[model samples]
Target: MLSQKAKYALQALLALAELDEGDSLMIGDIAEKQRLPKRFLEQILLDLKHQGVVQSWRGKNGGYALLKSADKITFGEIVRIIDGPLAPLPCLSRMAYRKCDDCVDEERCAVRRVFASVHDATTEILDSMTLTRALNGGEVRELLRGTG
Candidate 1:
């Protein structure tokens, strides 16, 4: 399930993605435009900045912008930044893998096998869905339909 924070972060990024080259939006403006809580957005943007997804400037005309192109930023990367691993089980996580305490044989575990396929499919789609693809109405619909 997508966390509220991750949802808001994606909303905010989509807003940023709409900006013209070299332009930026203030945090309050982003929150207002996206209908997000200003305080929560501030924290989310800060985390994204630290993760190098965004860059900020401080001045009368300063604001925030994507550090890279929209097509270069994938949904999987953003979700991982905001929500951590996409795996259903700790053992299935690539970045944060851990052995399940009760597991007797990981390779033979039916639950693990099923969820590993789930994780792989999920990550495959997500990693391929970039912000540019998301911003396109047709692409978004196709992706949701599992036909992209």
Candidate 2:
């Protein structure tokens, strides 16, 4: 599952995508359209601005818009920004790897091997899917690992 942060980010991005040229959405507007709370949407948009996924203009018409075209930005990248890591195990993670304590051998663990493949496959699909594609209701499956 996407974290609350990631879900909100996706929602906000979709809302921004709905705007016309040079048109920006206010926090309240995005929250209302996305059914998110204003305070939470504000923080999420701020973080997205920091990440350069979106930008904000400071004024009455100010809110946020994509720094780049939506199609150029992949879902995997956005998820990494908000969710930290997509991999189920830290050891299998590319961006956020940390050693697992219970594994007797990092190089030879069957559990790690299976999940590592899953992570790679998931990333492959997500890396190809863009924010616009998702906003358009693209048919990407949620590649959530574990926690059945």
Candidate 3:
């Protein structure tokens, strides 16, 4: 399941993608438009900025904007940034793998195998998806079809 913070981050990015390039969106405007809390968004945006995913400006027109084009950012990347690894189990995580404490033999672990499959498929879908495609109403099936 996606965390509330990750969902809010995606919403904020998608909202920013809707605007023209070089346009900055105020945190308050994003909160009202995306129906997220102002304080919460401030923290999320700060984290994103720290990750270099978004840039911030100060003053009357100051707010936040994507550091680059939407197509350059993947849902998987942001999800991992906000929610950590996408693997269902630690053993299945490519970036943060750890053997199951109770497992006798990872090679014979059926549970790991099943979860590995799930992790692979999930990663494939999420990694391939960009905010650009999503903002244009592209669906996962459509992205899989290479139409978006």
Which candidate has the top score in TM-score? 3
List TM-score per model, in order. 0.92, 0.87, 0.95
What is the per-residue lDDT of model 3 for residues 54-125, given as tens digits with 9 covering 90 to 100? 998999988889998898889999999999999999888878999888999999999989888888878988
TM-score, model 3 to reference? 0.95
Which consecutive 10 residues in model 3 have the weakest lDDT in total?
139-148
lDDT of 2 by residue, 17-85 (tens): 767768888888889988998998888888888998898887876777888888788878888888888
Best by lDDT: 1
RMSD of each: 2.0, 4.7, 1.2
Q: What is the C-alpha RMSD, rounded to one decimal, of candidate 3?
A: 1.2
Writing each residue's lDDT as its tens digit, candidate 1 over 1-148 gives 9899999999999999999999999999999999999999999999999999999999988999999999899889999999999999999998899999999999999999999988987888788898888888536456757887
Q: TM-score for candidate 1, please give it.
A: 0.92
Order the candidates by TM-score, highest first.
Answer: 3, 1, 2
Per-candidate clashes come to 0, 0, 0
